[model samples]
Target: MKRIWIIGLWIGFTLLCNPIQAQVINKPIVVLDPGHGGVDSGAISINGVLEKDIVLEVGKETIRLNRELFGNSLDIQLTRYKDILFSFDL
Candidate 1:
């Protein structure tokens, strides 16, 4: 299933980049950054929930909801796909 999805993504990318395309399809790019990592977790709740974890979860859910409910209109990208601090040099 994952392989199929990857192939589909590759095909889509190729089609989008092809010079024979008739016109450009404009889609809004949305970037969600999950903050805090390494030694920092931002704020911590009484229940031991970290702000970094919360923000990551929120970012993931926002992407899912946008895709499932919004007809996949936006191009969503998540910074630092895993649990890590974001850096321009990284």
Candidate 2:
């Protein structure tokens, strides 16, 4: 009937007018893991560039650039900050 049609139209209009805020993420999480550490020296280039050192440097730079470029909007985490090893027994 016309009453049912009107009710349906009213419900549709109400739903459409409301904003759908499913999820609002303020900041994203990121974990940068640089392979190899301590005694375990990873790949080495012919020019004596260590892979572990390079990856670590890259991770550091990424954090720095993210802060400088994006105003530190992301939650960045690094595994190791120095030339040391970490036990992964857990």
Candidate 3:
């Protein structure tokens, strides 16, 4: 029984330490845009809910779901992880 347990542990450890390879595809990179942020505050609902806040929340959720489904095989990038002001002049 002890020998079986030791072998099981060894097998588990080996699998855990094994590295996973990501599959690459010849496709255009995906750009996620979570728009509206900073002091501007694009739109405000009747309940005082801000559009910027909603957009950011939805964007994060989408990213989480995509990563779970695709694993490390996908190359995903987001424009802004947090609220930030954008200037046209700059």
Candidate 4:
């Protein structure tokens, strides 16, 4: 539970800070959703940081990594590219 979130945060931060290089390929399509947006902040940290914020960064970082580190081999997309909340008003 907590451990998983912590580890995920660490991995996201690490990948964001330290970049890698790989060959480019365009075949797979990846979609990521940063859970609990808008009014729901999901989990909260001791420092008052919200889980939504953390996961949002992770999602963005995943896209960045795919483009820069992995040479765009993956077509990564996010449910919400911004910090805005998702709505079912479609």
Candidate 5:
């Protein structure tokens, strides 16, 4: 009786945890913004490395890692992939 009860509980838990199939509509959008770019060098480290460059590099790496791990499971978008002039007045 105890074995049967445990089996029943396991089955119930499995069913509860399983993903349900829902009606397909539209997928959500994921936006990735790597802050600071162009004329805006952002912060400058003691080594003279620009914060914008570091942020961009890290962002790209993150995107790559996400792609490798999630594949098409997620929709990823980046604000800026390359360096560009952001503002002349900042």
Candidate 6:
């Protein structure tokens, strides 16, 4: 009937107009690369501090802060967690 058709159209229009939120949200990924390790020391500060050590500590601190502040919502990855040389093969 014509009345049934109009009711169906009105229902469809209402559904289309309603705002819908996405069910799945992709988490953001972050890669932290601390330069230099093992025998390769990136730079030497005037105070005799190694760049590799400093960078590694900084990377760790950043991860810690993110977890503490943002509940570790991001997928964070570290290139090297300790004093070891990593090979970059392109």
Best by lDDT: 6
**Whole-model lDDT values for every prediction:** 0.81, 0.84, 0.75, 0.81, 0.77, 0.86
- Model 6 off-target regions past 4 Å? 1-25
The regions of model 4 sitting more than 4 angstroms off are: 1-26
* RMSD values, in order shown: 10.5, 9.9, 8.9, 19.0, 12.2, 9.4
- Count clashes in each candidate, considering only residues at least 3 apart in sequence or on different chains: 0, 0, 0, 0, 0, 0
Tell how far residue 43 is off in model 4, in angstroms.
0.6
* Candidate 2 Cα outliers beyond 4 Å, as residue runs: 1-25
Find the candidate with the highest TM-score and give its number: 6
Task: Estimate TM-scores for all models.
Answer: 0.66, 0.67, 0.62, 0.65, 0.60, 0.68
TM value for model 2? 0.67
Q: Assess the local accuracy of residue 8 in candidate 6 as a C-alpha lDDT between 0 and 100.
A: 100
Q: Would you list the rank order by lDDT, best first? A: 6, 2, 4, 1, 5, 3
Candidate ranking (TM-score, best to worst): 6, 2, 1, 4, 3, 5
Clashes of 6: 0
Better of 1 and 5 by lDDT: 1
lDDT of 1: 0.81
Model 6 C-alpha lDDT per residue in residues 1-90, reported as the tens digit of each score: 999999999988876776341211355789999989999999999999999999999999989988899887777789999999988799
What lDDT does candidate 5 reach at residue 61?
85
Which of the two, 2 or 5, has more lDDT?
A: 2
**Which lDDT tens digits does candidate 4 get at residues 1-90?**
999999999988986775542222425778888888888899999999999999999999898888798777787878987667877785
Model 3 Cα lDDT, one tens digit per residue, 1-90:
999999999988876776341133543467777788888677999999998888888888877877798664455577778988676884
